[model samples]
Target: MREFLIFSRTARTGGKINPKNLFQEGRLDIIRDFIVEAFFTANKKRSAIVHCFLYGQPNPPLHLTITSSAPVSIDRVKTATLLSDLISKKKKIRGCEMKKESIIEFLTKASKTKTIYLLDKKGKSIHETKILPNAIFCFADHLGFPRKEFKRISTISAETISLGKQTYFAYQALMLLQYFLDEKGID
Candidate 1:
Protein backbone atom coordinates (compact mmCIF):
# COMPACT_ATOMS: atom_id res chain seq x y z
CA MET A 1 0.00 0.00 0.00
CA ARG A 2 1.05 3.59 -0.55
CA GLU A 3 2.14 5.29 2.66
CA PHE A 4 2.89 8.94 3.38
CA LEU A 5 4.56 10.31 6.45
CA ILE A 6 4.06 14.04 6.93
CA PHE A 7 6.10 15.97 9.47
CA SER A 8 4.31 19.04 10.74
CA ARG A 9 6.73 21.26 12.59
CA THR A 10 4.00 23.34 14.19
CA ALA A 11 0.97 21.03 14.31
CA ARG A 12 -0.48 20.51 17.75
CA THR A 13 0.44 17.30 19.58
CA GLY A 14 -2.81 16.51 21.35
CA GLY A 15 -5.69 18.70 22.40
CA LYS A 16 -9.06 20.02 21.39
CA ILE A 17 -9.06 21.35 17.83
CA ASN A 18 -11.00 24.44 16.92
CA PRO A 19 -12.24 23.65 13.42
CA LYS A 20 -12.76 27.32 12.63
CA ASN A 21 -9.32 28.20 14.02
CA LEU A 22 -7.47 25.23 12.51
CA PHE A 23 -5.04 27.55 10.78
CA GLN A 24 -4.21 29.40 13.98
CA GLU A 25 -3.95 26.21 16.00
CA GLY A 26 -0.71 24.79 14.71
CA ARG A 27 -1.90 24.70 11.08
CA LEU A 28 -4.11 21.71 11.58
CA ASP A 29 -5.95 22.83 8.49
CA ILE A 30 -3.01 21.77 6.37
CA ILE A 31 -2.98 18.39 8.03
CA ARG A 32 -6.70 18.01 7.37
CA ASP A 33 -6.20 18.97 3.75
CA PHE A 34 -3.40 16.47 3.39
CA ILE A 35 -5.61 13.73 4.79
CA VAL A 36 -8.42 14.63 2.45
CA GLU A 37 -6.12 14.53 -0.56
CA ALA A 38 -4.47 11.30 0.45
CA PHE A 39 -7.62 9.26 0.93
CA PHE A 40 -10.43 10.88 -1.02
CA THR A 41 -11.23 11.19 -4.71
CA ALA A 42 -14.36 12.50 -6.46
CA ASN A 43 -16.43 9.39 -5.81
CA LYS A 44 -14.38 7.05 -3.59
CA LYS A 45 -11.36 6.72 -1.36
CA ARG A 46 -7.91 5.63 -2.41
CA SER A 47 -6.10 2.66 -0.95
CA ALA A 48 -3.53 4.49 1.09
CA ILE A 49 -2.45 5.37 4.59
CA VAL A 50 -1.23 8.65 6.08
CA HIS A 51 1.00 9.12 9.07
CA CYS A 52 1.02 12.58 10.60
CA PHE A 53 3.92 13.45 12.88
CA LEU A 54 2.82 16.42 14.94
CA TYR A 55 5.37 18.37 16.97
CA GLY A 56 3.69 21.31 18.59
CA GLN A 57 2.44 22.69 21.90
CA PRO A 58 1.06 20.85 24.98
CA ASN A 59 2.84 17.73 23.72
CA PRO A 60 5.34 16.77 21.09
CA PRO A 61 5.72 13.75 18.81
CA LEU A 62 2.06 12.91 18.40
CA HIS A 63 1.56 10.34 15.67
CA LEU A 64 -1.79 10.05 13.93
CA THR A 65 -2.21 7.12 11.56
CA ILE A 66 -5.12 7.33 9.13
CA THR A 67 -6.03 4.39 6.93
CA SER A 68 -8.51 4.21 4.09
CA SER A 69 -9.45 0.64 4.96
CA ALA A 70 -11.15 1.85 8.12
CA PRO A 71 -14.92 2.17 7.96
CA VAL A 72 -15.40 5.93 8.15
CA SER A 73 -16.23 8.72 5.78
CA ILE A 74 -13.49 11.28 5.14
CA ASP A 75 -13.60 14.93 4.21
CA ARG A 76 -12.04 18.18 5.40
CA VAL A 77 -14.47 18.64 8.29
CA LYS A 78 -14.59 14.94 9.16
CA THR A 79 -10.82 14.70 9.10
CA ALA A 80 -10.55 17.59 11.57
CA THR A 81 -13.20 16.09 13.77
CA LEU A 82 -11.43 12.75 13.76
CA LEU A 83 -8.18 14.42 14.71
CA SER A 84 -9.90 16.23 17.56
CA ASP A 85 -11.37 13.05 18.94
CA LEU A 86 -8.13 11.10 18.53
CA ILE A 87 -6.10 13.79 20.30
CA SER A 88 -8.54 14.18 23.17
CA LYS A 89 -9.18 10.47 23.56
CA LYS A 90 -5.60 9.42 22.70
CA LYS A 91 -6.81 6.16 21.18
CA LYS A 92 -8.12 4.60 18.03
CA ILE A 93 -11.16 6.42 16.67
CA ARG A 94 -12.62 4.81 13.54
CA GLY A 95 -10.06 5.20 10.76
CA CYS A 96 -7.53 7.13 12.89
CA GLU A 97 -5.09 5.82 15.48
CA MET A 98 -3.18 8.15 17.78
CA LYS A 99 0.07 7.58 19.65
CA LYS A 100 3.28 9.19 20.84
CA GLU A 101 6.06 8.36 18.40
CA SER A 102 9.04 10.32 17.13
CA ILE A 103 9.75 10.70 13.43
CA ILE A 104 13.19 9.19 13.69
CA GLU A 105 11.92 6.12 15.44
CA PHE A 106 9.20 5.58 12.90
CA LEU A 107 11.57 6.01 9.95
CA THR A 108 14.22 3.76 11.37
CA LYS A 109 11.73 0.95 11.77
CA ALA A 110 9.97 1.52 8.47
CA SER A 111 13.20 1.65 6.49
CA LYS A 112 13.75 -2.02 7.28
CA THR A 113 10.63 -3.03 5.37
CA LYS A 114 9.53 -0.18 3.11
CA THR A 115 11.38 1.86 0.54
CA ILE A 116 11.64 5.31 2.12
CA TYR A 117 11.82 8.34 -0.16
CA LEU A 118 12.34 11.86 1.10
CA LEU A 119 10.56 14.46 -1.03
CA ASP A 120 12.77 17.51 -1.55
CA LYS A 121 13.04 20.12 -4.26
CA LYS A 122 16.82 19.82 -4.48
CA GLY A 123 16.84 16.07 -4.75
CA LYS A 124 16.94 13.97 -7.90
CA SER A 125 13.95 14.08 -10.20
CA ILE A 126 11.28 11.49 -9.39
CA HIS A 127 11.12 10.36 -13.00
CA GLU A 128 14.69 9.12 -12.79
CA THR A 129 14.15 7.07 -9.70
CA LYS A 130 12.58 3.59 -9.52
CA ILE A 131 9.75 3.58 -7.00
CA LEU A 132 9.26 0.12 -5.56
CA PRO A 133 6.11 -1.29 -4.04
CA ASN A 134 5.22 -0.26 -0.49
CA ALA A 135 7.13 2.97 -0.93
CA ILE A 136 6.81 5.46 1.91
CA PHE A 137 7.15 9.09 0.90
CA CYS A 138 8.40 11.45 3.58
CA PHE A 139 7.70 15.17 3.45
CA ALA A 140 7.27 18.21 5.68
CA ASP A 141 4.54 20.75 6.36
CA HIS A 142 4.53 24.41 5.37
CA LEU A 143 7.21 25.35 7.92
CA GLY A 144 9.30 22.37 6.72
CA PHE A 145 11.51 20.14 8.77
CA PRO A 146 14.35 21.62 10.80
CA ARG A 147 18.00 21.26 9.76
CA LYS A 148 18.79 19.09 12.72
CA GLU A 149 16.05 16.67 11.75
CA PHE A 150 17.52 16.46 8.25
CA LYS A 151 20.80 15.38 9.77
CA ARG A 152 18.97 12.72 11.74
CA ILE A 153 17.04 11.57 8.65
CA SER A 154 20.14 11.50 6.46
CA THR A 155 21.47 8.55 8.40
CA ILE A 156 18.33 6.49 7.77
CA SER A 157 19.16 5.55 4.14
CA ALA A 158 16.20 7.31 2.50
CA GLU A 159 16.60 8.46 -1.09
CA THR A 160 15.52 12.04 -1.71
CA ILE A 161 13.35 12.84 -4.73
CA SER A 162 12.12 16.06 -6.29
CA LEU A 163 8.83 16.65 -8.03
CA GLY A 164 10.24 19.72 -9.76
CA LYS A 165 11.96 23.02 -9.11
CA GLN A 166 8.67 24.66 -8.31
CA THR A 167 7.60 24.40 -4.69
CA TYR A 168 4.28 22.80 -3.87
CA PHE A 169 2.20 22.27 -0.76
CA ALA A 170 2.32 18.92 0.99
CA TYR A 171 -1.12 17.98 -0.26
CA GLN A 172 -0.23 19.00 -3.78
CA ALA A 173 2.97 17.02 -3.67
CA LEU A 174 0.99 14.02 -2.46
CA MET A 175 -1.48 14.37 -5.30
CA LEU A 176 1.28 14.64 -7.86
CA LEU A 177 3.10 11.68 -6.38
CA GLN A 178 -0.08 9.64 -6.44
CA TYR A 179 -0.68 10.54 -10.06
CA PHE A 180 2.82 9.56 -11.00
CA LEU A 181 2.47 6.28 -9.18
CA ASP A 182 -0.84 5.63 -10.82
CA GLU A 183 0.60 6.34 -14.27
CA LYS A 184 3.49 4.00 -13.61
CA GLY A 185 1.19 1.36 -12.10
CA ILE A 186 3.35 1.20 -9.01
CA ASP A 187 0.47 0.69 -6.60
Candidate 2:
Protein backbone atom coordinates (compact mmCIF):
# COMPACT_ATOMS: atom_id res chain seq x y z
CA MET A 1 0.00 0.00 0.00
CA ARG A 2 1.07 3.56 -0.70
CA GLU A 3 -0.11 6.47 1.40
CA PHE A 4 0.38 10.21 1.15
CA LEU A 5 -0.36 12.04 4.37
CA ILE A 6 -0.72 15.79 3.70
CA PHE A 7 -0.77 18.19 6.61
CA SER A 8 -2.42 21.46 5.67
CA ARG A 9 -1.49 24.14 8.14
CA THR A 10 -4.01 26.59 6.69
CA ALA A 11 -7.01 24.56 5.61
CA ARG A 12 -10.26 24.94 7.55
CA THR A 13 -10.86 22.16 10.10
CA GLY A 14 -14.63 22.07 10.17
CA GLY A 15 -17.12 21.10 7.45
CA LYS A 16 -19.18 24.29 7.74
CA ILE A 17 -16.79 26.50 5.79
CA ASN A 18 -17.82 28.04 2.50
CA PRO A 19 -16.69 25.92 -0.44
CA LYS A 20 -15.85 28.94 -2.58
CA ASN A 21 -13.54 30.21 0.14
CA LEU A 22 -10.94 27.46 -0.05
CA PHE A 23 -8.42 29.81 -1.60
CA GLN A 24 -9.01 32.35 1.16
CA GLU A 25 -8.62 29.58 3.72
CA GLY A 26 -5.34 28.57 2.13
CA ARG A 27 -3.78 27.44 -1.12
CA LEU A 28 -5.79 24.30 -1.57
CA ASP A 29 -4.85 24.63 -5.24
CA ILE A 30 -2.56 21.63 -5.32
CA ILE A 31 -4.83 19.41 -3.24
CA ARG A 32 -6.59 17.80 -6.19
CA ASP A 33 -3.33 17.15 -7.95
CA PHE A 34 -1.96 15.45 -4.88
CA ILE A 35 -5.08 13.30 -4.64
CA VAL A 36 -4.97 12.37 -8.32
CA GLU A 37 -1.31 11.46 -8.31
CA ALA A 38 -1.68 9.29 -5.24
CA PHE A 39 -4.41 7.31 -6.93
CA PHE A 40 -2.95 6.91 -10.44
CA THR A 41 0.71 6.19 -9.85
CA ALA A 42 2.68 2.94 -9.51
CA ASN A 43 1.12 1.38 -12.61
CA LYS A 44 -2.21 1.68 -10.82
CA LYS A 45 -1.43 -1.62 -9.13
CA ARG A 46 -1.07 -0.39 -5.57
CA SER A 47 -3.66 0.72 -3.09
CA ALA A 48 -3.44 4.43 -2.26
CA ILE A 49 -4.61 6.36 0.76
CA VAL A 50 -4.52 10.15 1.06
CA HIS A 51 -5.03 11.56 4.54
CA CYS A 52 -5.50 15.32 4.38
CA PHE A 53 -4.92 17.16 7.64
CA LEU A 54 -6.86 20.40 7.68
CA TYR A 55 -5.91 22.73 10.52
CA GLY A 56 -7.05 26.21 9.61
CA GLN A 57 -10.21 26.59 11.66
CA PRO A 58 -11.18 27.25 15.26
CA ASN A 59 -11.79 23.56 15.85
CA PRO A 60 -8.41 22.83 14.29
CA PRO A 61 -7.30 19.58 12.64
CA LEU A 62 -9.78 17.68 10.50
CA HIS A 63 -8.70 14.36 9.03
CA LEU A 64 -9.88 13.65 5.51
CA THR A 65 -8.97 10.27 4.10
CA ILE A 66 -9.41 9.26 0.45
CA THR A 67 -8.82 5.69 -0.68
CA SER A 68 -8.12 4.56 -4.22
CA SER A 69 -10.73 1.82 -4.24
CA ALA A 70 -13.51 4.37 -3.90
CA PRO A 71 -15.44 5.17 -7.08
CA VAL A 72 -13.92 8.44 -8.18
CA SER A 73 -15.59 10.98 -10.36
CA ILE A 74 -13.88 11.48 -13.73
CA ASP A 75 -14.52 15.18 -14.07
CA ARG A 76 -11.93 17.24 -12.29
CA VAL A 77 -14.36 19.98 -11.43
CA LYS A 78 -16.89 17.50 -10.15
CA THR A 79 -14.25 15.69 -8.16
CA ALA A 80 -13.03 18.82 -6.48
CA THR A 81 -16.54 20.03 -5.91
CA LEU A 82 -17.51 16.76 -4.30
CA LEU A 83 -14.50 16.91 -2.05
CA SER A 84 -15.38 20.43 -1.10
CA ASP A 85 -18.87 19.31 -0.25
CA LEU A 86 -17.51 16.47 1.82
CA ILE A 87 -15.38 18.92 3.70
CA SER A 88 -18.38 21.13 4.29
CA LYS A 89 -20.35 18.15 5.54
CA LYS A 90 -17.47 16.89 7.65
CA LYS A 91 -18.52 13.53 6.33
CA LYS A 92 -17.09 10.76 4.19
CA ILE A 93 -17.66 10.67 0.46
CA ARG A 94 -17.96 7.20 -1.04
CA GLY A 95 -15.67 5.37 1.37
CA CYS A 96 -13.30 8.20 2.22
CA GLU A 97 -12.96 9.42 5.81
CA MET A 98 -13.67 13.08 6.53
CA LYS A 99 -13.94 13.97 10.19
CA LYS A 100 -12.45 15.97 13.00
CA GLU A 101 -9.25 14.36 14.28
CA SER A 102 -5.85 15.34 15.58
CA ILE A 103 -2.59 15.00 13.67
CA ILE A 104 -1.16 12.71 16.34
CA GLU A 105 -4.20 10.50 16.13
CA PHE A 106 -3.65 9.76 12.45
CA LEU A 107 0.13 9.45 12.77
CA THR A 108 -0.04 7.01 15.64
CA LYS A 109 -2.26 4.64 13.70
CA ALA A 110 -0.36 5.01 10.43
CA SER A 111 3.08 4.40 11.92
CA LYS A 112 2.17 1.00 13.31
CA THR A 113 3.00 -0.92 10.11
CA LYS A 114 3.85 1.67 7.48
CA THR A 115 7.34 3.09 7.34
CA ILE A 116 6.72 6.83 7.52
CA TYR A 117 9.04 9.38 5.91
CA LEU A 118 8.91 13.12 6.34
CA LEU A 119 9.67 15.15 3.20
CA ASP A 120 12.28 17.79 3.86
CA LYS A 121 14.95 19.62 1.88
CA LYS A 122 17.60 19.19 4.57
CA GLY A 123 17.21 15.42 4.74
CA LYS A 124 18.92 12.56 2.90
CA SER A 125 18.03 11.82 -0.69
CA ILE A 126 14.80 9.86 -1.10
CA HIS A 127 16.48 7.62 -3.65
CA GLU A 128 18.95 6.43 -1.06
CA THR A 129 16.26 5.53 1.45
CA LYS A 130 15.06 1.95 1.27
CA ILE A 131 11.39 1.64 0.37
CA LEU A 132 9.97 -0.78 2.89
CA PRO A 133 6.67 -2.60 2.49
CA ASN A 134 3.59 -0.43 3.09
CA ALA A 135 5.42 2.88 2.83
CA ILE A 136 3.79 6.10 3.97
CA PHE A 137 5.22 9.40 2.70
CA CYS A 138 4.24 12.59 4.49
CA PHE A 139 4.31 16.24 3.37
CA ALA A 140 2.88 19.47 4.68
CA ASP A 141 0.90 22.05 2.72
CA HIS A 142 2.12 25.36 1.29
CA LEU A 143 3.01 26.82 4.69
CA GLY A 144 4.83 23.59 5.62
CA PHE A 145 5.00 21.97 9.05
CA PRO A 146 5.40 23.99 12.19
CA ARG A 147 8.62 23.70 14.18
CA LYS A 148 6.99 21.71 16.99
CA GLU A 149 5.28 19.27 14.60
CA PHE A 150 8.56 18.48 12.84
CA LYS A 151 10.19 17.74 16.18
CA ARG A 152 7.33 15.45 17.13
CA ILE A 153 7.67 13.67 13.77
CA SER A 154 11.37 13.02 14.39
CA THR A 155 10.55 11.55 17.77
CA ILE A 156 8.22 9.11 16.03
CA SER A 157 11.21 7.78 14.07
CA ALA A 158 9.94 9.10 10.78
CA GLU A 159 13.02 9.47 8.57
CA THR A 160 13.40 12.75 6.75
CA ILE A 161 13.88 12.27 3.00
CA SER A 162 14.46 14.78 0.24
CA LEU A 163 13.90 14.89 -3.51
CA GLY A 164 17.37 15.87 -4.59
CA LYS A 165 18.69 19.37 -3.80
CA GLN A 166 15.98 21.44 -5.42
CA THR A 167 12.69 22.11 -3.63
CA TYR A 168 9.60 21.20 -5.64
CA PHE A 169 5.90 21.63 -4.98
CA ALA A 170 4.17 18.84 -3.08
CA TYR A 171 2.42 17.44 -6.15
CA GLN A 172 5.63 17.56 -8.15
CA ALA A 173 7.35 15.67 -5.38
CA LEU A 174 4.70 13.00 -5.50
CA MET A 175 5.11 12.66 -9.26
CA LEU A 176 8.87 12.48 -8.90
CA LEU A 177 8.47 9.80 -6.27
CA GLN A 178 6.29 7.77 -8.63
CA TYR A 179 8.86 8.17 -11.39
CA PHE A 180 11.60 7.10 -9.05
CA LEU A 181 9.60 4.03 -8.12
CA ASP A 182 9.24 3.20 -11.79
CA GLU A 183 12.96 3.64 -12.35
CA LYS A 184 13.89 1.59 -9.32
CA GLY A 185 11.39 -1.14 -10.23
CA ILE A 186 9.98 -0.88 -6.75
CA ASP A 187 6.38 -1.62 -7.74
Q: What C-alpha RMSD separates each model from the true structure? A: 1.5, 2.5
Tell me the lDDT of model 2 at 55: 78
Model 2, span 14-38: residue lDDT tens = 5454445456646555666677777
For residues 38-145, what per-residue lDDT tens digits would candidate 1 score against the true structure? 887778788889999999988998888889865445656766776776767745666678778999999999899988898989988999998888778988998888
Point to the candidate with the largest lDDT.
Answer: 1
lDDT of 1: 0.84
- Model 2 bad stretches (over 4 Å): 15-21, 41-46, 90-92
Error of 2 at 95 (Å): 2.1
For candidate 1, the per-residue lDDT at 52 reads 91
TM-score of each: 0.94, 0.87
